[model samples]
Target: MIEILSPSRVDRARRTGALVGDILQTLRRRTEVGTNLLTLDRWTKELIEEAGATSCYVDYAPSFGRGPFGHHLCTGVNDAVLHGRPRDQVLADGDLLSLDLAVTLDGVAADAAISFVVGEARPAESVALVEVTERALAAGIAAAQPGARTGDISAAIGAVLTGAGYRVNTEFGGHGIGSTMHQDPHVANTGRPGRGYPLRPGLLLALEPWVMADTDQLVTDADGWTLRSATGCRTAHSEHTVAITEDGPEVLTLPRAA
Candidate 1:
């Protein structure tokens, strides 16, 4: 269901967005050479509880995933990309880690993700892959506005990724988010301009741009939740929740310092 958040909810959304962003930033900073996936999950759980917020993923049950995700956050490492369920894995130098988080505070929801390399081992290609997705995410956010269509955001993201020589995966992209985690107006990573749902005031969208290093194909891990690259190629993902406003698209998941 698509929800055009009421003004009061929008106010709460800003706070929710900040919370999600802060969580992601915290995870990014704490993730290091010896950090374990389970540790990250525990940290996330504690943070969300401390903030008096709810985790959108902990109990998320959809047809595509195993019921009751039972995790506080998604931790995709190296070749793993989306829906990365936390595991007993520990990080190594140069491991690319992606943290995706969604939370609801005061009945409003916000989602965000960040990709970073661990330790001093920053592979140039890995760095490039992360940069491209982050750039594409920025492009998608720039295209979000009250009269803009989903294609506008999709096209913007595709251009940045394809131009960087990475394959875009549309199987899972962005979507409308509000009081609920996922909603209508599916936003693909790549699409023609001027198509799909029209942006309207009060509409909240989560524009995520993710890419695989080699192929667009994906494979589900043994856990039946984490999405990994078919070729085991390194991957990266970036995302943010935005609110459509008469003034333009107000990024709800921006850092407080921004």
Candidate 2:
């Protein structure tokens, strides 16, 4: 379903966005070599609960994933990219980690994701992958203006990822988000401009740009949730929840300090 949030809801959405951002930032600061994925999940749960918010993923059940995600956060390391279910694994130096989070506060929801390297080592390829996704996310956000079509955003993101020599995957991409986590108006990572859903005030969209180093193909891990690169190449993902307004796009998921 597509939801055009009301003014009050939009205000609430800002709060929800801030909470999500702060939690992710906190987790990033606490992560390091030997950090366990479950530790991150626990930290996320505590933060969410402390804020009096609810997790959009904890009980999430969808056809594509194993029912009841049962985790407060998604931790994607190295080859893992999307729907990365937290497991009994410890991070290693130079490991690329991606954290995706969504939460609801005051009846509104926001979603965001960030990918970064752990410890002191920064592999050139890993750094490049993370940088490209971040750049693509920024390009997508820049294209999110009132009256602009979703395709415009998609094209902008696609240009960055493709230009960086990464393959784009459309099977899973950004989508409308509001009171609930995922909504209508599917936003692919790549598409022709001037097509798809028309943007308007009160519309909220989660724009995510993710890519694999070598191929566009993905393989599901035995856990039935984590999505990894077919070639086992490193991957990266960046995302933000944006609200379209008469003044242009307002990024709600930025850290409080940003």
Candidate 3:
């Protein structure tokens, strides 16, 4: 469903967005070599509870994933990209980790994701992959505004990724998000400009741009959730929830200090 949030709800959304961003930022900072994925999940759970927020993932039972994800956050490491279920895995130096999080506070929800390299060693390829996704995410956000079509956001994101010599995947991408986590108006990572649903004020969109190093194909892990690169290539993902307004596009999920 496409939801036009009320101004009061938009205010609540801003709060929810800040909480999500702060938790993700804290998790990113605490993640390092030897850090367990489960630890990150626990941290997320505690923080969300402390803030009186509810997780959008723990009990999430989407058709594409295993019922009741049962995790507070998504932990995608290296080959793992999307829907990465937290497991008993420990981080290794130079490991590329991606964390995706969503939460609802006061009946409003916000979602965001971040990719970063762990430890002191940063591989050039890994760094490049992360940078490209971040840049693509920025482009997507820049294209979000009142009267702008969803394709405009997708096209802007695609231009950046394709220009960086990376393949694009459309199976799973950004979508409308509001009271619930995922909503209508599917936003692909790549598409033609001047197409798809038209944007409007009071609409919230989660613009995510993710890419694999080598191929566009994805293979689901045995866990029935985690999506990995078909070629086992390193991957990166970046996302943020944005609200279209009369003035311009306001990024709700920006880091607290940002």
Candidate 4:
């Protein structure tokens, strides 16, 4: 469903977006080498409750995933990319980590994701991979203006990834998000501009651009979540929830201090 936000709804959405962004930023700062994936999940739960918000993932059960995600945050390490379900693994130095999160605040929802390297042992490939996705996300957001088509956002995102010598994966990309988590007007990582749903004021979209180091294929882990590169290559993902305004796209998910 394509849920358009009313003025009141958009206000609530901004609140929701702030919460999600704050939580992700907090988690990113807390994550470090030797940190267990479960610890990260626990931290997210605490923050959500402290903010008096609800996790959109706690009871989320989608067809592609094994019923009930059973976690508050998605912790993707190294080759792990989308839908990464936290596990018992401890992050090692230089491990590339991606955290995806969504939450509902005052009945409105927002979603975002971030990828980073764990420690000082920065691997050049990992650094490059993360930068490419971040750039793609920025491009997509720049294209998301009122009256702009979803394809424009997709193409903007696609150019960055492809230009970086990386292949784009469209299986699971960005989507419309509002009262609930995922909504209509699917935003693929790559597409032709001037196509797809037309953007309008009050429209909210979660634009994410993710890429694998080499292949575009993905395989689900046995845990029922944690999409990984088919070729075991490292991956990265970047996302943001934006609101379309008469002027342009507003990134509602920036953290408080930022």
Using lDDT as the measure, the top candidate is 2
Per-residue lDDT of model 4, residues 132-210, tens digit only: 9989999999999888899999999999999989988889999999988999989999999999999999999999999
Q: Which wins on TM-score, candidate 1 or candidate 3?
A: 3
Alpha-carbon lDDT of model 1: 0.91
- Global CA lDDT computed for model 4: 0.93
What digit string (tens of lDDT, one per residue) describes model 3 on residues 21-118? 99998998888899999999999999999999999999999999877899999999999999999999999999999999999999999999999999
TM-score of each: 0.98, 0.99, 0.99, 0.99
Estimate, for each residue in 44-150, the C-alpha lDDT of model 2 and write its tens digit. Answer: 99999999999999999999998789999999999999999999999999999999999999889999999999999989999999999999999999999999999
Error of 2 at 99 (Å): 0.2
Clashing pairs in 1: none
- RMSD for each model, in Å, please? 1.0, 0.7, 0.7, 0.8
- Model 2 pairs in collision: none
Error of 4 at 133 (Å): 0.7
